[model samples]
Target: MLARLLATAAVGGVVGFIVFHPREAEATGPTATVDADEAQRWLLGGNAWFVKGGRHVGDTSVERRTAVAPSQAPSCTILTCADSRVPPEHLFHAGLGDMFTVRVAGNVAEPVTTGSIEYAVEHLGTQLVVVMGHERCGAVKAALSDASLGPNLDALLALIRPGIGEIEDLDEAVRANVHAQVAGLRRSAILHHAEAEGTLTLLAAYYDLDTGVVTFLDSPPTSAVAEAAASPRTPAEGHAPTH
Candidate 1:
């Protein structure tokens, strides 16, 4: 009976050791990557916050310090004009790491701009791309006035010229510019592939500085009108038709 008791104790001790001293300790893995759909929802939520006039007064330095030590979440890519009036983060009421933004005069999409956007969508996995154009864009005005631009300014104007030709009226021109940029992005090889594969969405939007309301241009591309000021065809090209 003593021998049987010793054997049972040895077996129990062995089982206890096996349970306590696992061959491989399980450590916490990396944090999960934010999915594209979740990112989009976050972006819309930020916009809703803006619509409600929510204020974020937290210490940015503290937030930045914390995020610097680890990873952060970026939900959307906003391509907007360089107009001082349009502060992307503030307008969208987005906090740090909530948006990946690209700004250029007239919000023109050239190779460099497109490359940045491609990086955001392809590498950063941003699901929603907002092409935001604001009221009275200087670039559009310059294009309309045929103002002589400096070297860099010339290149900028060139990018916006096509869109200008599509609109006869200045107000319409502004809206058309947004539409043109959106269509340009849609036709972009990288963006088009992602859109076709249902990986990303491109939205064209105009921000009314007066009303503080952002109107999304949701009309089908076929129904939208191109600006006459930006088009190649002359006035003889027939009444400026809608897209």
Candidate 2:
């Protein structure tokens, strides 16, 4: 699965849904210890509530806020695009500090991004990592375009450009970018160690803006993922066809 995943850069138009479990409680202080499987349940169930139009946003009352004010013990770390439309908490109906999020234009796991997630995993006792990409993502659209964005935007696009190649389909592009970013996250030594030691659960997801459905991308076996992340890649790599 890692070889196949690494070999291709294009994401199919199909949406894959949720899976995986997390680390056991290892964090100290006010951080809450969350079971990865249980956390997945909350996210999946919360999404159900979201799709049903039920208000399931976890407690946000002053007391709830006060309790989590000292320190946050999020169950999962979500690395997703910074698109305003795809708020992880609202989409999953999660409440205060239920998740720790790292948002970027294309959800790229650059140095700082990886570091933030690592902090959650090592210090906060978060055992699960969910890397989500949404449909109609502006960052992806930008990456697919030939237009001249500013320096920073271009740099961001540079990171995304090689992931999906020249795929013209937006859905395909979004899917490809998500997996590529997942690979990038796995490259983090801290994250890789966590996965290798059986203390982490990594997953990919697709968010449909229209239907409000979050389809989790299929992940490879643990060993495969670890091996693939350990493998090196250059800027010229991963220009695969859309399936």
Best by lDDT: 2
Backbone clashes, each candidate: 17, 5
Among these predicted structures, which one has the highest TM-score? 2
What stretches of model 1 exceed 4 Å from their correct place? 1-45, 57-65, 219-243
Please estimate how well model 2 matches the true structure, expressed as its whole-model Cα lDDT.
0.68
List lDDT for all candidates, in order.
Answer: 0.58, 0.68
> How well is each residue in 1-243 modelled by candidate 1, as lDDT tens digits?
432232111110000000001011012211223444444333433343444454642113453434422333345678899888887776654544446688988888787788778867765556778898888777888877776778898888888778878566777787788888888888779999999998887888788777545656764432111211111221121110111
TM-score of 2: 0.77
Q: After superposition, how far is residue 233 of candidate 2 from its true place, in Å?
A: 41
Candidate 1 lowest-lDDT run of ten:
12-21
Task: Return model 1's CA RMSD, one decimal.
Answer: 21.2
At residue 91, give the lDDT of candidate 1: 64
**TM, every model:** 0.69, 0.77
